[model samples]
Target chain A: EAEVAQSPRYKITEKSQAVAFWCDPISGHATLYWYRQILGQGPELLVQFQDESVVDDSQLPKDRFSAERLKGVDSTLKIQPAELGDSAMYLCASSFGRGTEAFFGQGTRLTVV
Target chain B: ELKVEQNPLFLSMQEGKNYTIYCNYSTTSDRLYWYRQDPGKSLESLFVLLSNGAVKQEGRLMASLDTKARLSTLHITAAVHDLSATYFCANWVGSNYKLTFGKGTLLTVNP
Candidate 1:
């Protein structure tokens, strides 16, 4: 079955350093999402993209976080000057369309030291 | 803002037993989803409840949704070791299609 693909399964970075994560959604999927899961909490939406355009990013901290889906196929999430609290699992998911079931990727675990 | 709440944050049940996980959301939504996650792993989609009174089942798991009540449930039957995992309930906010998830219930099935 086709699945969302994420790169850098694990990342460890020093506080204040820059780090980036990549995600490639399943083919033909028009909606993509990036979520952050804390150690013992649920995943929270960081950003949502629809065909290369950002639909919502209310929860994203613009001061240090940025995400983009350049070609509407794959996406990249970056953190500049990462903070200690930024340690979490970054998950990428995709769906064929809005309000459809989303399939999640393996996710990238980031640990800020 | 939409908020999702789940009860019984941790559960320990014996094999062959049955139990249910409850999810309540703060706002009205027609779409609810259930997902499972193993330790140190990503999420696996379980069920999608699209309408009020919609119920779906697979294997030993059944999920139901009540859009009016803003509630969803995940029922596990004949629990087994393989069924042990963290389950989450997510609500889809309409306009942006953003999902707001609950804290999750960590279930441990003892054999």
Candidate 2:
């Protein structure tokens, strides 16, 4: 089975530093999503992309966080001047289209000191 | 806005015991999904409930959905140590691909 791939399974950085995470969705998937999971909470949607265009980013912290999928295939999420509270697991998921089941990646765990 | 809620945020049981995790949503949705996550790992899809009375089962875990009631359930039977993990239920916001998730239910099946 094809799976979504993520890089830097774990990242540790000092507060005020910049960090980025990468994700490659399964081939042919047109919908990609980025989610953040806190230690004791369920994942929350941060952004959604359709093809190479952003569909929704209402929950994303625009001031510090940014995500992009330039070619509608792979995506990158960056946090500038990371804060301690920004530590969490960043998960990537993809599906063939909207309103369908999505496959999740192993996720990148970020920690800010 | 859509909201999802799961009850019994934490559960502890011994081998052979049975328990159920409940998921309730605030609005009508197109589908409901259940996922399991082990510590320090990613999510594993457990079930996808798409219709009013959809139900699916795999091994010792069974999930049921009732769209009329806007509820879904994950039932574990004869649990084992391998079942120790956090389970999450998420609902697809109408028409959109976005999902609203409930606070996960952490299950600890003690041997």
lDDT, candidates in the order shown:
0.93, 0.93
Every prediction's TM-score for the first chain? 0.99, 0.99
| Regions more than 4 Å wrong, model 2 | none
Model 1 per-residue lDDT tens digits across residues A1-113: 89999999999999999999999999999999999999888999999999999999998999999999999999999999899999999999999988888999999999999
Best by DockQ: 1
Q: Spell out the clash pairs found in candidate 2.
A: none
User: How far in Å is the alpha carbon of B36 misplaced in model 1?
Assistant: 0.3
User: Between which residue pairs do clashes occur in model 1?
Assistant: none
Residue A63 lDDT in model 1?
Answer: 98
True contacts kept of each: 0.97, 0.89
